[model samples]
Target: MADKLDHLLSDYFRGKLDVAIQLRQMELTYRHGTPDENIGGGRKQNDYNNVVESRMIHEQNDPELKRLRYQKSVIKMMFDCLIKSHQDVLIDKYGNKKGWVTIGMDNHIDERTARE
Candidate 1:
């Protein structure tokens, strides 16, 4: 019964988080824009130009580059909390832990942004 309740709670939280994430994605997509390829009667041409120009400036600015650096960002802490914290709950629900999968995923993250 405890396991059943835990499963239900996990599902409930996962569903809520997924919905929140989708909503946030919609909001960001609205800003980062569409590949519609038409200026149309939508945002003015200058507004579109500004967004592109802003990105160009960001690409050039040293302070912006430093701020953008994820080098200081630790993905391990995130995985430790999200995956490690939930490992037992997941094993209880699914009967196995993906230890190698987690290790492989960490390897991918390191490979993705490694400056070395």
Candidate 2:
């Protein structure tokens, strides 16, 4: 169970940067506009139909974004609940990709303890 938690935390540390980047790109798309889908001669729909379709599409939730945000929040909540020393050890081992020896030395604990 400990190993599984460690692996999950390590993956979370690695993926957080990627998640931030993707979310930023999404934000930029919303800020600037999404690319024009109706380039050249496309279907000639009426203005009312176009407006209704756009509203429906925009109003729908994105499942991927929702999952990402939920995962981030849950991970953050778990991280926040740990004691400071354990948090430091986790950050060094997973976030910094440091070895157990180095983490033990930094925290002044036994190498085996740090690994555990």
Candidate 3:
């Protein structure tokens, strides 16, 4: 029962995190722009033109980046409440998307031990 519950919780958190990530990706995509393309070919392109385009890119992406950062911060804070090993396990399993066998190998433990 405990194992099943653990798996269920893992799936729940993974889904939540995935949704947050996908939303961020969509936000970024909607902000889609290519700096060079925007400033098309011109004979007298100067340093200021490049600088302006770079700034524009930063300004455009800032809001989406901030939203994503906040969501990730919230996730990290929640994970921080767990014991160290458990935190590592959850991060490796969900964030890194590793299988139990690979996680165990990376952490130098057996699969069953890693799963437990």
Candidate 4:
């Protein structure tokens, strides 16, 4: 479980920039409308066809973006509950991608304690 959480945190850290870029692109696409080549040709007609509904559907259907958002939120919630020292340790280890020895030294704790 710890290893899984660590992996998730690592992915969250690495995907932050990607998430931001994707969100910006989504916003721009919504604002300016999708390009002609990107639009699909379908003959199905639905009464629920509206810009707001389309945007909501587009966002909701994007699984990768949704997963990234969830991972980001989970990390944020975990961070919010931790003490300052623990938060710093997490940031040093995951956010800064520092080694255990370096993190321990920076925090004035031994390597084992830092790992813990």
> Model 4: which ten-residue window has the lowest total lDDT?
38-47
Which has the better lDDT: candidate 2, or candidate 3? 2
Candidate 1 lDDT over residue span 16-52, tens digit each:
4345434544444355535667657686555455755
Worst 10 residues of 3 by lDDT: 4-13
Residue 116 CA displacement from its true place in model 3, Å: 1.7
**What stretches of model 3 exceed 4 Å from their correct place?**
1-78
Highest TM-score model number? 4
Q: What's the TM-score of every candidate structure?
A: 0.23, 0.59, 0.37, 0.65
- Output the TM-score of candidate 4: 0.65
Candidate of highest lDDT: 4
Which residue pairs collide in model 2, if any? none
Off by over 4 Å in 2: 1-8, 11-21, 24-60
Judged by TM-score relative to the true structure, which candidate is superior, 1 or 2? 2
Q: Candidates ranked by lDDT, best first?
A: 4, 2, 3, 1
Per-structure clash totals for the candidates? 0, 0, 0, 0
Model 3, 1-116: lDDT tens digits are 97864564465456764575566656544564555554556654454647457655764667755665666677667777888887777778865679999999988889998888
Better of 1 and 4 by TM-score: 4
Give lDDT tens digits, candidate 4, residues 1-116: 98988877776666664666487548735666544463567644653547777777767777766776776777779779999999888888878899999999999999999999
Higher-TM-score candidate among 3 and 4?
Answer: 4
Checking candidate 4 for backbone clashes, the offending pairs are none
